[model samples]
Target: MTNRTFDEMQPGDRAELRRLITADDLFVFAAASGNSNPMHLTDTDVDGNGTAERIAPGMFMASLISAVLGTQLPGPGTLYRRQTLDFHTRAHAGEEVIVRAEVVSKAEGMVRLRTEVTHADGRQILTGEAEVIAPVEKFDREDVEVPGLVVQRHRHFEALLERARPLPALPTAVVCPNEAKSLGGALLAARESVISPILIGEAEAIRRAADEIGADLGGIEVIDVAGDAAAAELACRLVHDHRAAAVMKGHLHTDDLLKPMLDKAHGLRVGRRFTHVFVMDVPGHPEPLFVTDAAINIAPDLATKMDICQNAIDLALSLGMEPRVGVLSAVETVNPAIQSSIDAALLSKMADRGQIKGGQVEGPLAMDNAVDMGAARTKGLKGSVAGRANILVVPGLDAGNMLAKQLAFISHAEGAGLVLGAKVPVILNSRSDSPMSRLASCAVAAIRHFAGAR
Candidate 1:
């Protein structure tokens, strides 16, 4: 690589680089830049030209000029001052893009370059002009290692929304909409046609919060209620009365929402006990992970864990997956001292007795043995669920909660939560969760709703 100084640069100085625009490239770009307009990346989205091909963003094409200037022409130490761009045509994914830059003039340590980007077919996609301050003196630079980019795919939530798209928007009662994340989630799901939101909370408070967030709630139904508890009661009532198919927690404590549902008289309780599952999409993991008892069951006993395991298995079935339950413990052997290992052994035996259905159950396995085949083989663990478990049944709520949070924050996994074993799926979300999290929960509820009806 050569670094050209202002003294060495001439009128004819030029540089060019070619790169293939791949699907992963487009996906990373869209996610990193937050430019998720479907027309730019979605193949099924209709563009203005009535084409379905994935078109790259105009700025994405123009970025090649900057790359050329920094890495090739005035290579390294080039300071970009200004640039003018014109998009001539849309660049689709898988097309090879060639970027060429020619120095039009150089004066007073500044170089003016004429840049153009064309497809492999020689069709011009973008033309631009850049003014950069050239290095006055060249320095012999050693190769610097650049950090790799970490792209959060959020594909688990995306797939959930896709599954919910075919079904009509389920009418969902959102309790306590005075907060932005919850309200924004409800509105976003409604916009995507995943849920028809029936807002039940303080009307003026909801409107005020909406105004602060610039949410347009026009024509949306709002049922006025005083507090979070009242909102929860009404939301559950709507579900019980067949006025709503699902209930969403909004700006309220988890206990507030669950209290009304556990009433046993007016609640939405089915035959089973209510438990929560965090559907996690972890990068580098082969499949989606079902982490149970994370949100709802705090310190459940053996009987409660049975419900947790069954609920997670039912959820896996709802998502069209073959459930493989791993009874996770600290060690892979039954120890009376470690209650978790004992519970794991019992859970596995219970599955054999038809106490748990529709899932392959394996027990007393460490977390590594459950998910990693190599580790399981090294530990002499052999079973369908031992090495390839999709649903991990933790012994207690604390371990499950920490595992799910670690996957989400440390491993950059996307998590969508649902409380099952009720007549209707209850979407449970954290205040820090994104709108996509809420949408994903709604999608889960929608799938559960429809699947149960069948």
Candidate 2:
């Protein structure tokens, strides 16, 4: 960057910058300015005209002129004396604007500049004039670095919901929805058109739960079952009778919910054993992260681990993501002393030898090199699944459960749990899951059902 000295400046000398205003920019500006007006912060119809507007604050537009004055024209060591601004129109997120500044006049150690901000389509948004103490010394330097900002929002799950909204709502048998949290979650998914839930539990308890949440259960099917195990068994019967496309665990222990589905005579199993996968929407991650066998398959053997990998890979494919499986261990290299590292090596070789299909599998990767590019590079790892793994296959239930919880509590990720390898996807949400998590679980199940049908 080079700056024009006070003596070098002249009338009509101009500088301009084009900036694309983004939603993140608006949020950052709101945080920096401490202005939380709904008109500028929210993307909603403030005036009730119909168009949702995330209007950029007027001062945000004015700051563009400041950026131009400080970096360009009389670029460095510039001090603001006085400024006047006139708002002509509104700027919005996702719009580009041009901020231009022109030297109007010069005085003793001071310069006057005309500034204006206009939309990319030529509509003026803001016009202003500024007087500044221009730099007397000719200043030149490289660009300065600034820290980056990460907006902690769950965009991946939101996108998954959007993708699922177009599909036909999956017919889900919600087992034992006898409490407010579970019943409310199913109803919320129903409202979002992600699921058509058949409430299978005690009729009085179901209605009581509905009343507790102020929900109307009209036009929804409710099956009155007396016991948790009986309700789960009835849900399995519904799947066999072609009444439900999926089963949702609601307000019951996971063992009771899944035990009926494992019956050899009337089970929902197609072939492989059921394995749990947590589809985590971590903030700032480019895609969904899959953590598998978290809720089931405690200390799985090599065969069960293979099933876990295949189940997660299939789910990833159903969600339209090319699966890159990273079988995680304590170290990146196979060691005779470490059983997990040995298992990871075997999993990688098995995938290479066509034992596991539809995904790229690489393993014996520690947590760092599995998901982080810089860490992988530093460790001299080069492969598709080494650094950019979307699916993390852990050694046992303990590691998988801990990893998923760490991402949820520490990293602030939203997780949608699903049990795969059955005839239908099982929505395995917990009592502590937020509404969005439950809804996302339904969306994922619906998406997977439709995708598999195709």
Candidate with best TM-score: 2
- Name the runs in model 2 displaced over 4 angstroms: 1-10, 31-52, 73-79, 87-92, 120-123, 133-145
lDDT of 1 by residue, 1-454 (tens): 5588888889988899999996667777887799977877677847456668678888888887888998888877799999998888888887899999999999988999999999888999989889999987675667766887655676667777889988989999999988788899999889999999999999999999899889999989999999888889998889878999988888989999899889988888888889999888887566689999888777788899899889988889988999999999999989889989999999899999999998988889999999988999999888788789999988778899899999988998878889888888898899988676778888888998899789
Which candidate comes out best when scored by lDDT?
2
lDDT of 2 by residue, 1-454 (tens): 8889999999999999999998778888888999877787677788798988889999989888899999997898899998899999999898999999999999999999999999998899988899999999988878766788777778899899999999999999999999999999999999999999999989999999999999999999999989999999999999999999999999999999999899999988988989999999998899999999899999999999999999999999999999999999999999999998999999999999999999999989999999999999999999898889999999999999999999999899999999999999999999999999999999999999999999
What does each candidate score in C-alpha RMSD? 6.7, 2.6
Q: How big is the positional error of residue 410 in model 2, measured in Å on the Cα after superposition? A: 1.8
- For residue 250, model 1's alpha carbon misses the true position, in angstroms, by 0.8
TM-score of each: 0.74, 0.91
